[model samples]
Target: MNNSVWNVTSNSNLDTLALSHSTVDFASHGSTAGTFATLNVENLSGNSTFIMRADVVGEGNGV
Candidate 1:
């Protein structure tokens, strides 16, 4: 398999970011286990916080 990891970039007026109301868990099937995440940001706007580029954003929040 090829190694190709990436993150989403955003253009925002806000200079900071904060994760709120997020939950994470893991599921196991036989000998393997996978991770999951769930995130909720009721309000997304500028003059507030930025969309953070994280490896884990709770059930996998990605672009």
Candidate 2:
């Protein structure tokens, strides 16, 4: 689990911002078989442009 915050103050606009996650795993069986992941962002001013991108890579071992 992780938590992060960013504060920016500039006359010009931001070109790009990136977030990444690698090798997230889930239990094979039992009560922990399923998991939940979430990402939350708050813009106090509520007046900004945002572009989000996600990539998921899966590898199964016949579980």
lDDT of 1 by residue, 1-63 (tens): 012221222222433333343321122112223322333445543332223323444665563
Per-model clash counts, in order, read 4, 0
TM-score of candidate 2 relative to the true fold:
0.18
How big is the positional error of residue 29 in model 2, measured in Å on the Cα after superposition? 37
Give all candidate RMSDs, comma-separated.
Answer: 14.8, 14.2
Tens digits of per-residue lDDT for model 2, 1-63? 123233222122333334332222222122332233333334222323332223344645543
Candidate number of the best lDDT: 1
Off by over 4 Å in 2: 1-43, 56-63
lDDT of 2 at 57: 42
What value does the lDDT take at residue 25 in candidate 2? 26
Model 2 clash pairs are: none
